[model samples]
Target: MSDEKYRETIIEQAKKDQSAGKFQSESPGFRSLVKSYVSVVSPDRKNIITEGLTAIYKNKNPQPKTLNLIDYLLGNVKYCKEASDVSYAEFYDSNGEMVASYSNGKWISYGTKAENARESELWGIYNEAWNNAARTSQKNSYVAGTDTTIGLMDISV
Candidate 1:
């Protein structure tokens, strides 16, 4: 198929999948995410653009894992003031309390489970959790010194 036709096909199939509960409708971020994957995956892989787009719309990988907005709201999350690049860190702890800490680009763990795991795996988890939180936060409006969120906005922002 031609490039334009392929893109159009993707959009159509994505719409159908959305209605069938197969995946989410494409957001601007989702589109960008697919673009990134297409560039990387297309070099060595064919039909990756089509497959990746379909998988993402279906909330599956080869697409990056990210929690939906509802999950982000229910999660107990902490953001580090010192983290320049990190968005959020979620440690699965026995006590269920997570502390906001800086890495200084070094590996630091706040929990026992994290201590026993591979550093690379931990980094991926941290990044995915961070991305989900960041994505949800980006989609929602926020104002400093305000505790209100999303639908709770009092129109005073």
Candidate 2:
């Protein structure tokens, strides 16, 4: 196109936009409102231990005794509503292993190196192992903070 014609077209479009009062601005909040679809790690990672049921010795048997690991992460394993879409959480270890994992929304544990455990499948051995490890780890260690967010749906065009 000729320079004059291109300039005219630009001017025409600008006038139309101005008349309609429909121009966009470069504001930070606007940028955040229409962000590119990017997966972010959820920021909720902490070890939450629930107390296990206490046993009463009754009579005079020198008070009651505790059983098993801490009550925090036992038998209270909860699966995300969409567990299939969940990926293993990751953490660095002293040995520098990738240490992919699962968690109780709190504590985390590492998965196995077995081929099946590493593969993806519904209720796959690996998935189960990771879940177990995460729960166990949560029971044993302090909860770590995470900022990972998975993209479950997209609204941006």
Candidate 3:
């Protein structure tokens, strides 16, 4: 294509974008209404993961609590979820082992039977864990004050 013709085509597209109100070639332009899934280590997720883990362990019977400050670091734990109303997350440790998982808005604890306890009685732990995992992923970005939206469906918490 000749340079003149290429310029005309580009100009036409820009005009269409402006007419559709989807183009804003200026600083602080319109933020995208759509958000894509991103995976990254996030501070907010670290705090949440440890909080939920501690809460569940505290109520567990006959075991040391994972209440240490370092426990929530997330490390290599894969925090998975999506933006849908119904989503879930599985926390895989450094060695690619799933330590605990929350699914369908419920917490599924790993370990001995006594550790898991009764699902009916463990709603508190499940709720805390699920909310922390879901909300942060949908809201937090790898950068501060940016348009980047993350879908935890493939990242770590």
Candidate number with greatest TM-score? 3
TM-score of each: 0.19, 0.16, 0.23
Give the per-residue lDDT of model 2 (tens digit) for 29-120: 22232221110211112221121111111212232233234422232222222323322233322223333334445445443233223122
Q: What ranking emerges by TM-score with the best candidate at the front? A: 3, 1, 2
Candidate 3 per-residue lDDT, tens place, 53-82, comes to 454444433332343435534433333333
Better by lDDT, candidate 3 or 2: 3
Better of 1 and 2 by lDDT: 1
Candidate 2, position 35, lDDT: 25
> Residue 92 in candidate 1 has what lDDT?
22
Winning candidate number (lDDT): 3
Off by over 4 Å in 3: 1-48, 51-74, 84-86, 112-157
Q: Candidate 1, which segments miss by more than 4 Å at Cα?
A: 24-41, 45-157
TM-score of 3: 0.23
